[model samples]
Structure formats: structure tokens, C-alpha cells
Target: MDALANAPDILSATAENTRHREWRLPRRAVSWLQVLPLTAILVVLFALPTLLFLVVSFFDYDRTGIYPAFLLDSYREIFTSASTLRVYGSTLKFAAIVWAITLFLGFNIAYFLIFHVRNPKIRIIFFLLCAIPFFTSAIIRTMAWIPFLGRSGVFNQAVMGLGFTSQPLSFLLFSDFSVVIAYVHLYTLLMIGPIANSLSKIDRSLVEAARDAGASRWQIMAHVIIPLSKTGIALGSILVITQVMGDYFVVRQMSGGQSASIVSALSVEIQAMQYPPAAANAIVLVVIVALMVGCLLRIVDVRKELMK
Candidate 1:
């Protein structure tokens, strides 16, 4: 009689457990379904191309074109080539310089926009002004620098007229300086946009609390703001470095064939129909950039920021 009485309670508990599992299963399915499209897109677009290049990187190739045989000659040649070191050295130099300059400019501009600006309408107007240059084509923007920096150009003429120098600066065009200038003009926006987003998301009350505790403005910025904005800084660094490293035309045009880079080397190989070597070179660059991005992610939880 007791067993019969307790049977209903036991069955009720079982039903509750079953209902809990049933509820969880759909939630799990829905979560996965939400990410499915993005996963599919990544697989189709990025993963497949990377896999294909990785495969081709190991294949044998010659003047006769690619063959089915596996070989390491491409990578071996790339590592052994004398020009390879110089190209990468130049590329890395450009990347380091550009990254530093952009980070400094981007961080300060973002700080000003986020912390100092009080009026929403004025802030929007300032942001629009920053973004206005970006609406133009990159090619046009890049070429525009040529005329502006040339001998007897507007900038040179102004400087000379103002008695800043007797002659137009030769280093202003077709040199490393020119390349860096163009890169800063174009890529500073990439850094500013990300850093501004990060700064905007930071809690303003934290800054007020820090000031209340006897911290100066600089102190508050150094301790409170920088810690939270590291993710944006890292992201901006990645974008600037990668873009500088992959540039073929800007360096080419600005340096007047004096500087060479990994992309330029890759372009040379591609034009010469050296498929395996080009693929190997590309894969190596991809690996380097991936390592950099991975290191940055280890320092900051960008995933959490994105989730928020």
C-alpha cells in the first residue's frame, strides 16, 4: 500500500526530470542554429581557400607548371633566398613604424572624442569629418598624395613660401617618409574607429570614482581607461600591421622601387608563374599574422567584449 502511494511521487519526479531535459535540448539547438550561418560562411570562404593554398604550397612546380608530387622545395627556396630576408625586413620595418604612429594618433583622438566631448551633435559631426575621407576610393586617395608631395606641389610651395626651407624637400616624395605619410592618412581611421568604440563602451562612473579618490586626469586615463581599452588597441595594432605588411602598391609607388615587401615578392612570383613558391610565401605570412593575433587575444578577452 505504501509502495503504491509513493509511485505517484516517483513518477512525478521522473516527469519533471524529463521535462527539464526536453527544455534544454531545444535551447542548445537554437544556440547552435544561430551560429550555423556564420560557421558555414567561414568554412566556405576562408577555410576552403586557406586549405587549397596550403595543399598547393607543398606541390612541386617548375616552368612547366604544377605537378602532383609533394615537395618542400618551395619553402626551402623561400627560406634560402637572399632577397627574401631583405623583403621581409623592409615589410616588418614598415609595419612596426606604421603601427606605432597609428596607435598613438588613434588612441589620443579616441580619448578626446570619448572623454572630452560632451555634446552629442558635435561629437557626431567630428566623427563624420573623420570618416569623410574614407568615402573616397583608396586608389584615388593614394594617388592624390603624389601631386601633393611632389616638387613644386601645394605643400612644398606653402612651406617654401613660409621660409621653412629654401628648396622643396626631396625626401617628401618617393621615399620611406612618403610611404609612412600615406599609410598614416589612410589607416589611422582603422585604429581610431575601433579604439573609439572601446572607449565609448567604458563606464564613465569609473572615471569619476577614480577622480574622487584623488587621481588626476592622466592617472585615471593611465589606470582605468587604458586597462579597458587594451582590446581596442590590440585590434587596431593588428589591422594596421596586417594592412602594412600586405601592401604592394603603396610601398611600390611611394618608395620608387627602393623598398620591397612580402606582397611585392609574392606578386613577382605570381607574375613569373611560380605558383608553389607564391603559395608557400602566402602561407608563411598568414602564419605570422595568425600568431600575432593569437598573442593579442591571450592578453585581452575580446570575445567577452564582442558578446557584450
Candidate 2:
């Protein structure tokens, strides 16, 4: 009789536990719920806009207006145009140069802050100093370079005053050099932010262990830090590349209209009421950017690297 009575109690406990679990959701379902808002926003904003452009890119258009139809002429024209090739080549060149410069600056700066600095307060202060420029308008920042880099600008005046040169440097403003300078100023922060975040999460104990094993700073950085920071470096490179590829004004103003970006060419098409061709350009640029990012991801399994 006692054994039979205990069986009933055990059954009741199991049933109660099952009932409690019924009130909880599966982890996957909870994950989906968490992402629902952003997914909806992306579908509405990015997805819908991209779809709209894709449709317009296929439509027929001319001097009269855009017509509703499917055609390959827009893509054909874009692919066939030598001007399109030149603009894209120029944009890629800019992206590549900017990515290299930003990566070096960002990695070194982040490394110093995360590893070299013992004081948390000073590290944060230095990071804030790097970010302080962002509080001002980007346009103002780009234009400010004019007075600092022009023939009679601060930099030129300083060089001449110090007898470094007989005349002010002409290439300092309104040239490819100036465009690069502006890009580095604007986008280096993007690189620094991602890299700093990645470096911060690294296990400090591993670095110490490496040092105890007689690993020099260079060896530790080569074998440990660089391997660990791949995700950050890739992310920073992506940000810098994309920003340089899509830019218009900085190149235009700083280069003195001598150079044009893919987007600048696209902007020209838009201004001329060439919607189909402009939409085509937009789609192509998106594809190119996506391909470049994809290549970076392939180079580093960023997901696996970060999780580890």
C-alpha cells in the first residue's frame, strides 16, 4: 500500500513539472521574437527599397520617361560604358587605399589603448579624444581641411615658415591626396570603434601566459593578438571600404571635380532624370560592395573567430 501511494506522488510531480515547462518557449522561438522588430524594419526599409530599385533597373526608360517593362538595355549600357568602368576603377582604388591606411592606424591605436594602457580612465579619455571630431558636422570637417591644407593654409604656412619649402604645396588641396586625407579623417573612427571593441573582449591572461613562455611582444602579437583580432580587422576594413566606395562630396570638393566616384556618376544619372540607368548603377554598386564584403568574410571566418 505504501509503494502504490508513492507512485501517485511521483506521477503528480512529473505532471507539475511538465505544466511549468509549457509556460516557457523554445530558445529558437525566443531568438526569433527578439529579432522580429529589426527584421520588420529591414524588410520595410532595405528590402523594399532594394526591390523597388531592382524593378526600376529592369524597366525601360528614355528622354520621355521611364516605362514599365522588363529589359536588359540599362544593364547593357552600364556594362558597356567606358565611363562606368573608369568611375568604378577609381572608386575601388580609393576604397583599397583608405582601407589599408585606416586598418594600420586603427589597429595600432586600439592595441595601445587595450594593452599598453594600465589606467582605465586614461584609455577612455584617449578614446573620447579620437571621437571628439565626430561631434562636429562632417561637411564642416571636410571643409575645415581646406584652410589647413590650402596654398596659404596652416600646413603650407608652417612648412614655409620653417623653410622646408620655397612655395606652398599645390597638391595638398584639390587633389587625390586631399581626398585621401579627408577620408582617413572621417572613417578612421569607424575602424577604431570595431577594433577597440574586439580587442577589449580578448582574454588578458592569455597574453600574460605568452609573455611568461618567453614570447616577445612581436611574437605575442603575431601569434596571439593578430589571430584573435581578425574579426575586428575585417570589420574595420569593410566599414572603411564601403564608406570610400559610396562617397561623393569629399572626392568632389577635395579633388576639385577632377575625379568622380561610382556614386557621383550615379548621382549624375539621377540628376539627368535617367532613373532606369541610375537604378541600374545603384544595383551594380550594391552588388560590388556585397562582393567585397563577402571576400573579407571568406578570408576570415569572422563569426567563428568572434565566438572563440
Candidate 3:
């Protein structure tokens, strides 16, 4: 009789405990529902197209951009040929050099913004200075580099006026160096944002504590700041590297097809109606970028940092 009487109360308590656990688990799941539309859009838009492109990359294309059923010839050609190898090497080199430069410059700028600029309004202003360039059309920005670096451009004029050289520098307008410079200018903002966001979250007191403990500036930066900023650095590097790797407009506009990055080569293939080769090149680029990003993620807890 006693057990029967206590049964309803015990059951009610168990139900309440379960409900409490459910509530305490997390509210994040609810937020994730908002991403469903984005996920659906990506699937319908990007994923489908990417899959189709991958499928077409193995086939042969005619002058009309029509693909016929074929074998692995495109991939084989891209892999086995020395010309294709050189394109890949050049693309990798450009991306690497741009990544390194952007990483260094972006980190320094972001650090200065977060640590040196104490005023919120002023900090925001400085950030806006970096961001405003993006509001302009990217194509326009690329074109803008031309007048500054062309034979009759501002850069050449300035140098000639300074008597730095007897002749206009031909190297500035249509070379790999120009492409890299333009890429750095275009992508530096991306690098700065992640790094600044990361650096801003770090507790200022940690730096102070290190200094109080007689740690030198370099030691504090190396041990405390750099480790904490690893996530930002990784993210920045990924952004710069990916942008540089897949870039087309800047390379084309600045180099005028005189130089061949992977992107420029892909553009040429596309223009020549060689869809299969272009698709193959794109797939290779995507794979390379994916591998690079995966490697970077290994060093930094990107997920955790992004969530925070």
C-alpha cells in the first residue's frame, strides 16, 4: 500500500529531473535552426554546381564548350604535363609569398589597433579605414592599381622625377610581382579583421601580469600573446591563402595575361571554351585549398575560437 501511494510522486520527480537536464544541456541547438536556410541555399546553389563541375572535369570539351563522354585524359594532361606543373608551382609560390606578407602586416596592424588604440570610437574609425576599400567594386580597385603602376603611372612618374632610374620600369605593370602586390592590398583587410577580433578578446591584464613578472616584451608576445592569437593567425592565413589561390580579376587586370597564375591559366582555358580543362583546374585548386585549410586547422582550435 505504501509503495503504491509513493509511485506518482517518484514518477513526477523523475520527469522533473529529466526536464531540468534538458534545459541545462544548451540553448545553442535552437540557434542552429537559423542556419538551416543557409545550409539549404548552399546545397541548392553551390553544392549542386560544384558536383556538376567535378563530373564534367573528367570529360572532353569541344570548341563550343560542349562536353562529350571521355576518360581521365584531362586530369592526366594536367598532372603529367610540365606546363601545367609550372602553373601549379607559380600559383603555389604566389599564394605562399602573399600569405606570409599579409600575415605579418595584418598581425602587426591588428595588434596595434587592439592594444594601442584605447578609445572605442577611434578604434572603430581605424577599422573602418581598413573596411571602406571593400565597399568599392573589386574590379574597380584592380583597375585603380594600373594607373598607379603603369608606364605612365604615378609610381613611374614619381620614380623618374626622383631620378631613381633612367627608364620607366616595365616590371611593375605586367608581372607576378604586381599580381602579388594587388592581392596583398585586396586581402589585407580580411587578415586584419580576424586577427583584431582575436586580439581584442584577450585579457589586457594578462600582458600586464607578464610584465609585472619581469618578462621581457618579446617573451610576453611569444608566450602569452602569440599562443592566444594562434586562432586568429590561422584564420587570417587561410583567408589570405584562399583568396590569393583562387584570385582571377586582380591577376588578369594587373598582369594582363602576361603572367600565368593558376587562376589566369584557368581563365584562358575557360575563354578558349575548354570547359573540361577549366573544371579540372578548378577542382585541383579547390583540393589544394582544402588541404591547406585542413593543415592550418590542425595547429589552431578554430572551432573553439570562432564559437567564442
Candidate 4:
């Protein structure tokens, strides 16, 4: 009778445990549930459009309309055409230059804001000052540079007034130099924001400890700050690279038809109703950017760092 009573208790406990497991979700399942909304949004907004582009890139198009067909002509032309190659090369060149300049400016600016500005209110004020230019539209800001850098504009006039040169600098406006100036103006903030965020996460004691160990400022920066801030640097680089690569307006307006970005060339094709070729161009650009981001991710595990 005692054994029979104990057996009933054991059976009831087993039943309760099974019910509990059925009600409780696994940790992995919870994570998936939390991310499902974002996944859906990305698929709808990004992945689907990319898929459409990939599919359309293979189609055929004529003066009348695009037709469903499998063709490599678009891809072949992009690879073989010298003009296309030049556009790609110019785009890459601009991206690399802008990236380097932004990285330098962003790192220093972020370091100043994060480390030097002891007052939180002062830091916020400085950050707001850096962000003031971004209150206006990008197009408006880009156009503002035209007047400033023009041969007869403020900068040239100032230089001429100072007797720095006898003539207005022709190279200052409607050239690669102006294009780079505009790019740096527009995108440097992108770098600063991320790097500041990364720098803020660093512990202050680590620097003090380094100082106590007789480490030089440069040594501390190279060993502690840079390594800790890699995630920010990588994020900022991606932002700058992608912005420069995809930009058409700044290059168009600043370079005065002398230079063309990949997007500007793609825009030309789209305007001419060359949908297939435009799609092909877009897909190629996407692949190249993806590769660049992948390389950065390889260097710094952004996901892991961010999670920590």
C-alpha cells in the first residue's frame, strides 16, 4: 500500500514537469521570436528589392520595354567597357580617400569629445555643434560648398584679398578637390557618431592603470584605445564607404560633369529606360560594398563587440 501511494506521487510529479516544459520556450526560440520582426522588415525592405534587382538584371530591354530573358550582356558590358571601369575606379578612389580623411577626423574628434571634455554638458554642447550642419538637407549643404569653393566665392575671394594668389584658384571649384571637400563635410559626422559611441564605452581606469605602469600616451592609445575602439572605427568606415560609393548628387554637382560616380552612371542608364543594365550595375555595386563590409567585419567582430 505504501509503494502504491509513492508511485502515484512520482507519476503526478512527472506529469507536472512535462506540462512545465511544454509551456516554457527554449532560449534559442525566444531569441528568434525577438528578432522575427526585424528579420521580416529587412526581408521586405532590403532583401526583396535586392532579389528583384538580381532577377531583373538578367532580363532583356529595348527602346520599348524590358522583357523576361536570360542574358549576360549587361554584366559583360559593365566588365568590358572602359567607361564603366573608369566610373568604378573613380568611385573606389573617392571612397578610399574619403574613408581615410573621415577616419582621421572622426577618431580625433571623438577622442576629444569623449576623453578631453570632462563636463557632460560641455560634451553635449560640442556634439551638438558638430551636428549643427546636419540639420539642413544634404543637397542644401552640398550646394552651400559650391558658393564657398567657387572661383569667385568666399574662399577664393578671401585668398585673393589676402594676396595668397594673384588669381582665383580654378582648381578649387568644379574639380575632384571640390568633390572630396563636399564628401568630407557631409560624411565626417557619420564617422564621429560611431567612434564617439565606441570611445564612451571604454573604462577610464584602464587609461589611469596604463599611466601608473609608466606607459606613454601614444602607447596607451595604440594598445588600449585603438583596440577597444575597433568596432566604432569599422562601423564608421562602412558608413563612409557606402555613402561615398552610392552618392551621385555630390559628385555630379561638385565635379561639374567632369567626374561620375557608379551611381551617377547608373542614374544615366535608368533615365534612358535601360532598366536591365541599371539593375546589373546596382547588383555589382551591392556585391562590391558587401565585400568591403565583410572585410571590415573580419577584422573586427562588430556583432560580438556590440553585444558585449
Highest TM-score: which candidate? 4
Summarize candidate 3's per-residue lDDT along 169-253 as a digit string, tens digits: 9899888878888888888998999999899889989999999999999999999999999999999898889988887777677
The predicted structure with the larger TM-score, 2 or 3, is: 2
Each prediction's TM-score versus the true structure: 0.90, 0.89, 0.86, 0.90
Tens digit of lDDT per residue, candidate 2, span 1-308?
99854754565555556665763444445456556778999999999999999999999888989999999889998889898888888888888888889999999999999989999999999999999998999999999999999999999999999999998899999998999999999999999988988899889999999999999999999999988888898988988898898897899889989988889888998999999989999999999999999999998988887777
Q: By TM-score, highest first, what's the ranking?
A: 4, 1, 2, 3
Ranking by lDDT: 4, 2, 1, 3
- Candidate 1 or 2, higher lDDT? 2
Candidate 2, run of 10 with poorest lDDT: 23-32
lDDT of candidate 1 over 1-308, digit per residue (tens): 99965755665555556765586665555556556778999999999999998999998887988987689998998789888978888888888899989999999999899889999899999999999999998878888998899997889999999999998988899999999999999999999988999999999899889999999978988999999998899888888888987898898878888887799879999999988889999999999888878888898878887677
Write down the RMSD of candidate 3 (Cα, Å). 8.6
Clash count, one per candidate = 0, 0, 0, 0
Local distance difference test, candidate 2: 0.89
Off by over 4 Å in 4: 1-33
Error of 1 at 201 (Å): 1.7
Off by over 4 Å in 1: 1-21
- The residue pairs found clashing in candidate 4 are none
Q: How accurate is candidate 3 locally (lDDT)?
A: 0.86
lDDT of 4 by residue, 16-53 (tens): 56665663444445456556778999999999999998
In model 2, which regions exceed 4 Å deviation?
1-19, 23-30, 303-308
TM-score of 1: 0.90
